[model samples]
Target: MTLQSVLQSLLTAFNSLGRSRKLLLIVLVIILLLYSLGPRLFGYGTYKHRYQDPNTACMAQNLIDFQSRIDNLDAFHSGDFADAVASKRMAYVGNGNIAAALGSEKGLYIRLNRALSQPINFWPVVQTRIEGSKKKSTVLDVKSGLAYKMQVLSSSSGCINVGSQLYAHRSRPALLVQDIRIQNPSTLPIVVEMDQIRDSGWEHVEIADASFTINGAETVKYKIYSSTVPLLKSDKVIAIAIASVSIESTTERVEANSIKKFHLLTAVHYTQPMLAEEAPKYLPDCIQQAKGELEKGLGINEKLLRQEHTHVWGKLWYSGFSISHSKASGAINGDRINRTLYYVLSNAQAPLHNVMSTQQDKTNIEKILYFPDNCYSGHSTLKSDTLWIEPEDESQIARVVTTWMITLEKLGCKLMVGAVKLTDPVTSVLYITSDHQHMQELKHAIHVKEINEAPAHEHHVIALHKHGHHFGGLPTIFWVSIALLIVVFHLFLFKLIYNEYCQGQERYSRSRYSL
Candidate 1:
């Protein structure tokens, strides 16, 4: 049809429409025009909101001004997780051989390793109870190697505040210490009942005794004023933990506006008995070493101990890399990076003096190299044409793979292949290394995975399907629904236009006939 004729027919059809339908048509046209040009007309709004808001604009400047104050205060602070008596938020503190996951509610779980052997688990080293106080907050200071918590008991008669610091001694790796301070800020004396009950797992325990010998062996004696709990058996004990509470009284009367102090200590010792004959000698040495550590740790002043701990951590920070960010999201990411470094370093130990310099150590270098593996592994060799797969989230896989790459580079191993495929919540990492022996050892040490000769991308898809995560990036149903909606909208618009044109043609024919 001619353009003029079509325009005339459309205009006539629109004019003949009912008032409501005409109004609807006008609204539809306006909507369509706005949809086409809205971004161009209002694009400046985003810039204005982001740059004009005082809070957002000042974030970077504020971070710069307060950067130094927060440098040594790498802490995870939480105030809301301390409501109930049993409320717990766990934070980890460790020194390579010994690690503890402590809850905000004064619960502790320990893990002990001997000569890089498998770790032994010890739960609830000592149960803690406070009669009349509620937890206020918990702060895990990674830089200082301390976990701090505050509790307050308030009543009409008096107010009492309790602050506690829990830390793994940096100087003495096996020592764990807790300091509690009670402050009474009232005219009346407040009677506080605090108890550190020994765990049920601890058998043949003694509280008041200052020392204990394990397995009837006088040589294997621990000289701590606490109970000794041996794991495995008395004769074949692989690990032992000593726990002590300094406060003799279950209830302490705090004088008006005064303070009372108490402390708890736990020491762990373990030995790797390679042969049956070595158990006796090694067990005694382990106990003696633990005793010496406790004695030395106890001799140091509390303030000095904290200073030494912080100094050690300061050295770590100085030696390691630093991350800085000015934007809010960048700041959050920086915090996460610091925490990740803290976790890895907390469980790492420095090399012994002259250990790395010796020819024997050089020959056993592979045995000395350690990598944290909490995910899957697969077997492959330097000359083998095989793929190693790891099933984990993308971020976790990235971290693990990055750690592996760094360690492997230090060992002079070439990285042949590294690839990652992300399928929403499930992610897979494929790696091909030039060191087959190292890969095989790692496979045996960590969780094992199936070796896939298929292409990396295809294997990832297969793994995801096996895990019931078939949804790729977006759901298939979602895209299908979206397409269906678009089709229906176009069909409706076409039908409306065709009906208007048909009605207009009929009227035109009738008018022509009448003429």
Candidate 2:
């Protein structure tokens, strides 16, 4: 407030920057030079829009033609397999065995759209990342950050107060967030906010006129609340919500209805998941069973090592999430960088690489899953690294349970699902976060022998049929009867043809010589 004080503050700031100022200025100049000479840099992309224009129709038609060409299997285009197989890691980890599988690399695609405000300007860029994955039926952790080239999207339309909370950017045009759906997933009670305005340290939103009728039906609210994607009971596509702020919460996941349910078909060829009361017993028995068959050269494929994979519908998110939290200075729009974004971004995260081998050296995890020592912990709220086994294989995967029961029971986790058909060899389980920092806790195992990569299968040797045929050799009665018949026939043939016929031939020859 005083000239001396202002002068002192300026001097202090200058002193702080003393030597570093030269380096900072040099860095700034280099960056300015690069951007001025650099090709366009892409940031986060916007929501995908439906084809509503004539050009869109033409593009759609072109796409259809291209698809038809592919369907015909024209030799000119070898196939999707060519390039993918070239990159042999083509086998998706998600589609492999649970215990032995790992998640895959992820990326975000970007584009820009603005009519007037940002003509010839770069569009918003989206930076996507795989937060993490779990073996649960739902819940995929995802983290995203954003950088803008063009301006952000906002509504010229009027805004409504969310819970009477006045945002720092109340005078500036507030953000207008609309339909935010949890695609292919269920609705969960998440802490939804329009945008965390950093300046005021409060969540804000632009909630207004988001409902519109579809096919003559009543317009629905933007957000759903369900354990699945509908966000509500009986509804299919829940309206999207316009929440600027969201806290860590649980929810159900949904998928495109077009995606069909995949079930493992168990025949003699299917891999079987073995369950036992003790690991020591299971290990020995499995080894013995496999060795016996290998020595005799019977069903040798029964013990080959295999990998694990999943067929999960992954979670979707964008980069603006971090940006909205970061740049929001006092009275600044959510699009600006601020403390909230820094807070959300300061930490780091990793994807799902389930505990395959607990060995000190995480070498190639052949056929086993090495879970955490406290995997079975009963804690309702677990740390980020914790694994949660679902209830389905409670009885069948008894070995996993029994081995880790002390920990699981203590943690208060329960089991679910129907009894084993004595046929299904694969087991399913869910792993969850024990703590909050971007959890991707998933545990999986495909054992040594495997079938499909979706989960560990139940494999049965073809020995039962082979055993019956092998032991059912020759019968005593039948063998004796055949021997007796052969002996009698031999004697009869000797008397009728050998002796009498030869004598007659000799007598006729002598009579002819005498005459």
Candidate 3:
């Protein structure tokens, strides 16, 4: 009964306007509602530019590694998975009991040795048998005259038990088993000594005290053997890898100091159905030991040493060396199964002038793995989060390129980053020091991989959810705006109907009074 009542009466009169006026009011309410949703619809494009660089290779590795781990409940309970087990490489409890019960061609269990996109069907491979006319038997029969074979350990990163034997879990003294492994496939009764294994790749043709002329000109000749059979000069990579094993324990103490320090790290594959059972406990304990001893990592002997993958670096650059045999092409392609050298960047104190005139141009260099502050020589299931030096501009690159062949000496992995000596590149080898000297390089590269800062994916993009919230008790902004518009339209329609009804009632009262 005051100013408010007078305004209400005026508002009712205005609401009694025509249908066109009512329609305009509804349209106005809809426009206001849409205004609330405007920002989110157009805000996406502004946050999409942080992931465009070559350093993205490291980023890609990080992304794929994470994707490999995301739980797909749909796949597991659906019964569509297969598991592969490498038994020869399983746990070893006794001194000589390291070798397991044997399987067909290779071991009691074949090496999963590479990362498969999905769980592999080992039954088919295990059941697979060679035809009588195939290579193994045929080759043996053909060489019946007076066959000699050799057994080699290509490379390994395992815990070593040095000195004597053991007692309980605490008994085995740990030591670095660089380039070490037991030989089940070795050409039975042959030794591929440690010295020969150290000088296996093309990078060190110059480092070797003695050289084997491919033409076999001299009697003091150097040799290349696979298992026991000496290889012809033209022998292939697969042949070399098959006969190689990386053994650490028995290797000379001097050589042991030359390899890189081992780090305990996490891999994406740790969550697989096969790995899930063991990885949870084994991975952490192993990583913890490695971390505790990072200052002085303790490498011990375990039958499962090879299976658990330990990290180590090359003391010297020897990419293609074999201890027991020649390498095979198949081995090179499948290096990811047992990834070796983890690439890193170094802020080497080395000067810029140290860089060569040729390396001045980034385009001219063969490849740039770690720049001034990058780490991790490269990556894989086995060697993740391992660290190394970043190359200074010129001379360092020259040094690695001029004298290197990418080797899987530890896990038989090859050429993780820069080109090995014989590796084909338009430019000469460009080196960002891929060694373990620089700690900063390793940290930065790891940070990139962990945060998934690379790639133009949803994860990398910034989400404004934290800041895009509503205010004043609003219902998620969008909902509130929609509700407000409906309220506005209903109120306008109600006023129109109420005003008409009120006028009719007043007229009826006036007529009754007149009567």
C-alpha lDDT score of every prediction, in listed order: 0.51, 0.24, 0.26
Clashes (backbone N, CA, C under 3 Å), per candidate, total 3, 77, 73
Q: Please give me the total number of clashing residue pairs in predicted model 1.
A: 3
Supply the global lDDT for candidate 2: 0.24
* Cα deviation of 45, candidate 1, in Å: 18
Decreasing TM-score order of the candidates: 1, 3, 2
Poorest 10 consecutive residues of model 2 by lDDT?
Answer: 109-118
Q: Estimate the Cα RMSD of every predicted model relative to the unseen true structure.
A: 13.1, 37.7, 24.3
* Model 1 misplacement above 4 A: 1-73, 83-88, 104-133, 155-159, 202-208, 211-237, 241-246, 273-281, 320-332, 351-437, 440-515
TM-scores for all candidates: the values are 0.51, 0.14, 0.21
How far does residue 5 in candidate 2 sit from its true spot (Å)?
99
State the lDDT of candidate 1 residue by residue for 379-400, as single tens digits: 2221121112221221232234
When summed lDDT is taken over every stretch of 10 residues in candidate 1, the lowest stretch is: 382-391
Best-performing candidate as measured by lDDT = 1
Superposed by TM-score, candidate 2 places the C-alpha of residue 171 at a distance from the truth, in angstroms, of 71
What is the Cα-based TM-score of model 1? 0.51
All candidates in order of lDDT, best leading: 1, 3, 2
